[model samples]
Target: MTADREITRRHAGLLDRLKRPELDVDETDDEDLRHLELRRVVLEVAELDHAQEIALVRAAVARFGKAGQA
Candidate 1:
Protein backbone atom coordinates (compact mmCIF):
# COMPACT_ATOMS: atom_id res chain seq x y z
CA MET A 1 0.00 0.00 0.00
CA THR A 2 0.93 3.63 -0.36
CA ALA A 3 2.55 5.55 2.49
CA ASP A 4 -0.51 7.71 3.07
CA ARG A 5 -2.72 4.65 3.25
CA GLU A 6 -0.38 3.05 5.70
CA ILE A 7 -0.41 6.11 7.91
CA THR A 8 -4.19 6.25 7.76
CA ARG A 9 -4.38 2.59 8.68
CA ARG A 10 -2.03 3.14 11.57
CA HIS A 11 -4.10 6.04 12.80
CA ALA A 12 -7.27 3.97 12.60
CA GLY A 13 -5.68 1.12 14.48
CA LEU A 14 -4.41 3.42 17.19
CA LEU A 15 -7.79 5.07 17.62
CA ASP A 16 -9.53 1.71 17.73
CA ARG A 17 -7.17 0.53 20.41
CA LEU A 18 -7.71 3.68 22.41
CA LYS A 19 -11.46 3.22 22.25
CA ARG A 20 -11.61 -0.52 22.73
CA PRO A 21 -14.00 -1.52 25.53
CA GLU A 22 -11.45 -3.89 27.07
CA LEU A 23 -8.79 -1.23 27.41
CA ASP A 24 -8.08 -0.97 31.09
CA VAL A 25 -6.84 2.42 32.07
CA ASP A 26 -7.48 1.66 35.70
CA GLU A 27 -4.79 1.78 38.35
CA THR A 28 -3.41 -1.70 38.27
CA ASP A 29 -0.04 -3.29 38.97
CA ASP A 30 0.73 -2.80 35.32
CA GLU A 31 -0.20 0.89 35.41
CA ASP A 32 3.34 1.90 34.58
CA LEU A 33 3.40 -0.37 31.58
CA ARG A 34 0.05 0.91 30.45
CA HIS A 35 1.23 4.49 30.78
CA LEU A 36 4.30 3.74 28.75
CA GLU A 37 2.21 2.11 26.06
CA LEU A 38 -0.11 5.05 25.89
CA ARG A 39 2.79 7.48 25.77
CA ARG A 40 4.44 5.55 22.97
CA VAL A 41 1.27 5.34 20.91
CA VAL A 42 0.39 8.98 21.45
CA LEU A 43 3.85 10.10 20.39
CA GLU A 44 3.64 7.94 17.30
CA VAL A 45 0.23 9.26 16.40
CA ALA A 46 1.25 12.83 17.10
CA GLU A 47 3.65 12.63 14.22
CA LEU A 48 0.64 12.57 11.92
CA ASP A 49 -1.26 15.63 10.75
CA HIS A 50 -2.88 18.13 13.10
CA ALA A 51 -6.38 16.94 12.19
CA GLN A 52 -5.54 13.42 13.23
CA GLU A 53 -4.05 14.63 16.52
CA ILE A 54 -7.28 16.48 17.22
CA ALA A 55 -9.32 13.39 16.37
CA LEU A 56 -7.21 11.28 18.67
CA VAL A 57 -7.77 13.67 21.57
CA ARG A 58 -11.48 13.76 20.92
CA ALA A 59 -11.78 9.99 20.68
CA ALA A 60 -9.80 9.56 23.90
CA VAL A 61 -12.00 12.03 25.72
CA ALA A 62 -15.13 10.32 24.49
CA ARG A 63 -13.88 6.89 25.41
CA PHE A 64 -12.49 7.76 28.85
CA GLY A 65 -15.19 10.23 29.82
CA LYS A 66 -17.99 7.68 29.57
CA ALA A 67 -17.42 6.69 33.19
CA GLY A 68 -18.60 10.12 34.34
CA GLN A 69 -22.04 9.82 32.82
CA ALA A 70 -25.17 9.58 34.91
Candidate 2:
Protein backbone atom coordinates (compact mmCIF):
# COMPACT_ATOMS: atom_id res chain seq x y z
CA MET A 1 0.00 0.00 0.00
CA THR A 2 1.03 3.61 -0.53
CA ALA A 3 2.15 5.96 2.23
CA ASP A 4 -1.34 7.45 2.38
CA ARG A 5 -2.72 4.07 3.46
CA GLU A 6 0.14 3.04 5.68
CA ILE A 7 -0.86 2.06 9.26
CA THR A 8 1.71 1.84 11.99
CA ARG A 9 1.42 -0.70 14.82
CA ARG A 10 0.33 2.10 17.13
CA HIS A 11 -2.67 2.58 14.90
CA ALA A 12 -3.90 -0.83 15.98
CA GLY A 13 -4.60 0.49 19.45
CA LEU A 14 -7.40 2.52 17.99
CA LEU A 15 -9.22 -0.68 17.13
CA ASP A 16 -10.06 -1.40 20.80
CA ARG A 17 -11.88 1.91 21.15
CA LEU A 18 -15.58 2.48 20.46
CA LYS A 19 -14.91 3.00 16.77
CA ARG A 20 -13.49 -0.46 16.23
CA PRO A 21 -11.96 -0.77 12.82
CA GLU A 22 -11.89 -3.82 10.61
CA LEU A 23 -9.72 -6.65 11.83
CA ASP A 24 -6.70 -6.79 9.54
CA VAL A 25 -8.26 -3.77 7.94
CA ASP A 26 -4.92 -2.72 6.58
CA GLU A 27 -1.57 -4.40 6.11
CA THR A 28 0.76 -4.22 9.10
CA ASP A 29 3.37 -1.57 8.18
CA ASP A 30 6.01 -2.83 10.61
CA GLU A 31 5.54 -6.46 9.57
CA ASP A 32 5.69 -5.57 5.91
CA LEU A 33 8.89 -3.58 6.37
CA ARG A 34 10.51 -6.39 8.38
CA HIS A 35 9.47 -8.93 5.76
CA LEU A 36 11.08 -6.85 3.03
CA GLU A 37 14.34 -6.45 4.89
CA LEU A 38 14.43 -10.16 5.66
CA ARG A 39 13.82 -11.00 2.03
CA ARG A 40 16.70 -8.76 0.95
CA VAL A 41 19.15 -10.36 3.38
CA VAL A 42 18.11 -13.85 2.34
CA LEU A 43 18.50 -13.01 -1.35
CA GLU A 44 21.94 -11.44 -0.90
CA VAL A 45 23.14 -14.38 1.16
CA ALA A 46 21.86 -16.80 -1.48
CA GLU A 47 23.68 -14.94 -4.24
CA LEU A 48 27.00 -15.07 -2.33
CA ASP A 49 27.17 -18.88 -2.42
CA HIS A 50 29.92 -18.46 -5.08
CA ALA A 51 29.19 -21.89 -6.53
CA GLN A 52 29.53 -22.12 -10.30
CA GLU A 53 27.59 -25.39 -10.42
CA ILE A 54 24.29 -25.98 -8.70
CA ALA A 55 25.46 -29.48 -7.75
CA LEU A 56 28.34 -27.98 -5.75
CA VAL A 57 25.99 -25.90 -3.66
CA ARG A 58 25.30 -27.78 -0.46
CA ALA A 59 23.07 -26.78 2.43
CA ALA A 60 25.98 -27.04 4.85
CA VAL A 61 28.34 -24.09 4.69
CA ALA A 62 31.94 -25.20 5.06
CA ARG A 63 33.34 -21.76 5.68
CA PHE A 64 32.48 -18.12 5.84
CA GLY A 65 33.76 -17.38 2.38
CA LYS A 66 34.55 -13.89 1.22
CA ALA A 67 31.34 -11.92 0.83
CA GLY A 68 30.88 -10.98 -2.82
CA GLN A 69 29.95 -7.49 -3.95
CA ALA A 70 26.23 -7.09 -3.96
Candidate 3:
Protein backbone atom coordinates (compact mmCIF):
# COMPACT_ATOMS: atom_id res chain seq x y z
CA MET A 1 0.00 0.00 0.00
CA THR A 2 1.04 3.58 -0.54
CA ALA A 3 2.23 5.58 2.46
CA ASP A 4 -0.80 7.85 2.23
CA ARG A 5 -3.20 4.95 2.43
CA GLU A 6 -1.31 3.45 5.31
CA ILE A 7 -1.47 6.69 7.25
CA THR A 8 -5.18 7.04 6.59
CA ARG A 9 -5.76 3.52 7.81
CA ARG A 10 -3.83 4.18 11.01
CA HIS A 11 -5.65 7.44 11.61
CA ALA A 12 -9.00 5.70 11.19
CA GLY A 13 -7.93 3.02 13.61
CA LEU A 14 -6.89 5.58 16.21
CA LEU A 15 -10.17 7.42 15.91
CA ASP A 16 -12.03 4.16 16.24
CA ARG A 17 -10.20 3.35 19.42
CA LEU A 18 -10.88 6.81 20.76
CA LYS A 19 -14.59 6.31 20.22
CA ARG A 20 -14.65 3.17 22.33
CA PRO A 21 -16.03 3.55 25.86
CA GLU A 22 -13.14 1.68 27.37
CA LEU A 23 -9.82 0.35 26.21
CA ASP A 24 -8.85 -3.18 27.25
CA VAL A 25 -5.40 -2.83 25.73
CA ASP A 26 -2.22 -3.74 27.53
CA GLU A 27 -0.32 -0.66 28.63
CA THR A 28 3.11 -2.10 27.83
CA ASP A 29 2.35 -2.56 24.14
CA ASP A 30 3.73 0.03 21.76
CA GLU A 31 0.47 0.23 19.82
CA ASP A 32 -1.44 0.81 23.02
CA LEU A 33 0.96 3.61 23.87
CA ARG A 34 0.08 5.24 20.57
CA HIS A 35 -3.62 4.99 21.33
CA LEU A 36 -3.16 6.55 24.74
CA GLU A 37 -1.04 9.30 23.25
CA LEU A 38 -3.76 10.06 20.74
CA ARG A 39 -6.23 10.34 23.61
CA ARG A 40 -3.97 12.87 25.27
CA VAL A 41 -3.65 14.88 22.08
CA VAL A 42 -7.39 14.88 21.54
CA LEU A 43 -7.96 16.18 25.06
CA GLU A 44 -5.50 19.00 24.42
CA VAL A 45 -6.92 19.81 21.00
CA ALA A 46 -10.39 20.04 22.48
CA GLU A 47 -9.33 23.31 24.14
CA LEU A 48 -8.37 25.08 20.88
CA ASP A 49 -10.57 27.96 19.70
CA HIS A 50 -12.27 28.04 16.28
CA ALA A 51 -9.46 29.96 14.61
CA GLN A 52 -6.80 27.73 16.09
CA GLU A 53 -8.68 24.70 14.86
CA ILE A 54 -8.91 26.20 11.38
CA ALA A 55 -5.22 26.99 11.36
CA LEU A 56 -4.40 23.50 12.57
CA VAL A 57 -6.52 22.00 9.82
CA ARG A 58 -4.83 24.21 7.24
CA ALA A 59 -1.37 23.21 8.39
CA ALA A 60 -2.24 19.53 8.54
CA VAL A 61 -3.79 19.64 5.10
CA ALA A 62 -0.74 21.42 3.75
CA ARG A 63 1.48 18.65 5.04
CA PHE A 64 -0.76 15.61 4.60
CA GLY A 65 -2.77 16.84 1.62
CA LYS A 66 -6.31 15.97 2.67
CA ALA A 67 -5.98 12.59 4.30
CA GLY A 68 -2.40 12.08 3.19
CA GLN A 69 -2.99 12.31 -0.55
CA ALA A 70 0.21 12.91 -2.46
What are the models' TM-scores?
A: 0.26, 0.20, 0.26
**RMSD (Å) per prediction:** 25.5, 16.5, 24.6
- Give Cα-based local distance difference scores for all models: 0.76, 0.56, 0.76
How well does candidate 1 match the true structure, expressed as C-alpha RMSD? 25.5
**Segments of candidate 1 deviating more than 4 angstroms:** 1-47, 67-70
User: Order of candidates by TM-score, top first?
Assistant: 1, 3, 2
Decoy 1 TM-score against native: 0.26
User: Candidate 3 residues 1-70, lDDT tens each?
Assistant: 6999999999998898775586676756866567568665785657777888899988976887556653
Off by over 4 Å in 3: 1-47, 65-70
Clashes of each: 0, 0, 0
Give the TM-score comparing model 2 with the true structure, all chains together: 0.20
Q: Candidate 3 vs. truth: CA RMSD?
A: 24.6
